[model samples]
Target: MTTLLCDADGTLFPSEEPAYAASAEVTNRFLAELGAERPFAPEELQAMTNGKNFRAAAQELARGYGRDLAGADLDAWVGQEKDVVTAHLRTVLRPDAAVRDPLRTLAGRFGLAAVTSSASSRLAACLEVTDLADLFDAARRFSAEDSLPVPTSKPDPAVYAFAGRELGVTPDEAVAVEDSINGALSAVAAGFPTIGTVQFVPGDDREARAEALREAGAAVVVSSWAEVVELLT
Candidate 1:
């Protein structure tokens, strides 16, 4: 059985817009309070935040404005951004309808598991909001924050490798679905045949991003969940 170990953000759910919106809002507000320059462009913001955690993103945002924020300043900014996003998570995060049917179809054909970098509570909210909680059960769902011992970030294969173990499958018997370059690297490096989704990337840059993902070790690049299902099926 090819266990489907999927990412929640950008894979099962629509997370890019909300994430970017919150990042932009937080960045601009922080800059204004400090009387710094204006926010970075969307592409710059994407490059900074797409693959990094909140602290990294905050630090990058500060660096973009010609400021260096570290230590307590950086951590406080990251915390503020996270708090803002968490406050609006339920309103902003949504599931792609295109993924739901495909997931339902694939569930019977293959083992399904959700491997996410999201905090467990946020993941639960996202799943519940999308009515997808039932699709992945407790045992099948793996959150990086599920346990303190588990590393809580990607581009480190620990989470993907752990998911394969919990699913009782080897990398060759599974597939990893991802939308970001770092996520693809994590899965592919862990020995899963990774599929890159370009749905979250801007349409103009998708080809470039697809090429990047290909270089990052995706077996294929797809534009939507439909293509993902077609490839998996």
Candidate 2:
């Protein structure tokens, strides 16, 4: 049977704006704390950590400011930023109502699973908030916390591969729907047919962002759930 593996952040959840804003805010605060000359632009900041795992993103942000963070300091910084971002997410994250019909339609034809870079608690919260808890079960849900090394995040197909195995589906029998460059790369690397969604990108930049996702490894780029429903069906 075909399995539809969906991403959480910008795919089912409309969290791009809040996530980007929170990251930028936290990064700017960190830079100020370090007495940096300038903060990174929104695009630059997001591009740096968009699909990266937590440790990697934190390290990159530190390096951008020429800070050699290690041990407790690094952990503290990363933790603080995460707390801030999580708080912001709590206030704004919501389901993409536009995907409701598509999800319902596809449910009849394919098994569904959620593959996300978030931890278990966060993922659970998202599913609950979106009323998608019934569509995904614990066995089929894969999160960053589920990774063997404990924090192995995306762009490293480990999570996707694990999800495929857990769901008893082979790469060819699964389709990954993603909304970020890294997310697309991870799915493609895992050998799933990948669809990139531009729903989270700004209207003016959708074309460029979609192109970037395609370059990153997505087989197709779509702007709406209607298009995705058509393509998959």
Candidate 3:
């Protein structure tokens, strides 16, 4: 049976609108506190923030601000933003039932796992909210916390590799479901058959992103996780 490695954010749960908004608010607050002008608009920040872990995004923003903020400051900033974002998220973010049912169906036929850039704690919260917390084998949940060295952030193959390792499978035998270009690329790089979910319709860029992933070797680009199940099954 093929082992399925899925991305968490835009793949398992809907894009966190509240978290994105809170990120903008916190970023603006941080800038104001640093006595700096807003360097990027909310949309721009959101674009950068997507498909990245909080710490990495925070460090990138710090560099953009010329703050050289690292270590504790970066950690604290990420922690604060997560707390603020998750509070708002608890009410709004929900799983796509369309995807969940297929996952339940597929689970009986394949070994299912979640490989995400999110921290375990945050992933746990999302899983609980989505009612998918108990569906996965506990050993199959791979998170950023399991990332080694530079933290196995996506677009890099390490995260997918870790998930495959946990399942005792080769990446080639795994099928990865992702919603972002980076996440799809990571699986492709790891030699997994990758399916990209186009969660947003970003006009010209949407086609461009899909083309890029296809060029980078994604097996297919789909609009929903249900398509992934159909393709595999």
TM-score (C-alpha, index-matched) for candidate 1 = 0.81
Q: How close is candidate 3 to the true structure, as a TM-score?
A: 0.87
Q: Model 1, range 1-74, lDDT digits (tens) per residue? A: 47888888777887666766766777777767666666655456767667555655555556766788876776
Clashing pairs in 1: none
Which residue runs of candidate 1 sit more than 4 Å off their true CA positions? 27-38, 41-43, 55-79, 145-151
Collision pairs in model 3: none
Per lDDT, the best of the predicted structures is 2
The lDDT ranking, best first, is: 2, 1, 3
Superposed by TM-score, candidate 3 places the C-alpha of residue 157 at a distance from the truth, in angstroms, of 2.5
Please write out the lDDT profile of model 3 over residues 93-140, one tens digit for every residue.
666688679889888788889898777767777887888887776678
TM-scores for candidates 1 onward, in order:
0.81, 0.86, 0.87
Tens digits of per-residue lDDT, candidate 2, 1-233, equal 48999998888877666766877877777767777788877578776678664556766667866887668876676676667667777777655568777888888889989998776666677677777777787777888644456567788888898888878899878899999888898899989989999876778989988999889888899988778889878
How should the candidates be ordered by TM-score, best one leading? 3, 2, 1
> lDDT of all the models against the reference?
0.76, 0.78, 0.75
Better model by lDDT: candidate 1 vs candidate 2: 2
Instruction: Show the lowest summed lDDT stretch of 10 residues, model 1.
Output: 144-153
